[model samples]
Target: MPYAVDFDTVSTAGLESSPVAPALAGLRANEARYFRNKYAHVFAVEPAGDAPEAVDWVHHILDAERGIVISSPALEATTFQVENIRMAYVFYRSGLSINVMYTVDDGGKRAVGFKLSDGMDVPDELASFKFARQRSKLAGTIRGSYFVIKNEY
Candidate 1:
């Protein structure tokens, strides 16, 4: 079943196994707040096991673009299209969140973003990228980095 992320009252429903569950929940809420504010859309997620295609799409980009593979166990994921953008989000047990943003129209923006939850170390795969900090009431100081998509997927 899908559950809408609640920014007002964050929950770690599917992320309880993570050591940084609180921070992960906050990170999840941050994304929810963003969509609600910018797109007037609700951000919802389901168990990663239930969304194999979404997980596979992310893996395909990671492999093709950078030869990178994340070993972290994905706990929850969601894929949706809104306002011409196809987005896929996966939350890992390591408190890492990755999102693939692909614009539907050709020649538009496409990239993979990585956001680290509070108190989690930068994953080895993303250690080379410099993360910029952004403050959020729900997520605290968020460190984020992204790389532009190089090939069609």
Candidate 2:
């Protein structure tokens, strides 16, 4: 079953297994609010076991583009299409969240983003990447980074 993230209230009903569940939930909620405000799209997440395709999609890109594989166990994932962008998110047990945003149209934006929840350490794979800080009432201080996608998937 998928849990529809409530941007307004910010809940982590299905993400309790993560070590930093509170921060992860808030991070999820921050994303929900982004889509809701920018594109009027609702963000919904499912257990990682239940969303194999979504997880695979993100993993495929990580391996192909960066030769990177996440070390943490994935707790939940979600994928949605809005306008020309296909967005996928994976939340990990280490409180790290990754997202892939691929634009369908040519010459549009394409990138993979990594975000760390409050109180979590940066994973080894992303240790070199510089993260920008963003303050969110729902998520607290979010440290994030991104790399442009050079290949079409």
TM-scores vs. true structure, each candidate: 0.98, 0.97
* Candidate that would win on lDDT: 1
lDDT of 1 by residue, 1-153 (tens): 889999999888999999999999999999999999999999999999999999999989998999889989999999999899999999999999999999989999999999999999998988889999998899888899999998888
**Any idea what lDDT model 1 has?**
0.95
Q: State in Å the error of residue 16, model 2.
A: 1.1
In order, what lDDT does every prediction score?
A: 0.95, 0.93
lDDT of 2 by residue, 3-109 (tens): 77997887778778888899999999999999999999989899999999999999999999999999999999999999999999999989999999999999989
Which regions in candidate 2 have their CA more than 4 angstroms from the true location?
Answer: none
lDDT of 2 at 73: 91
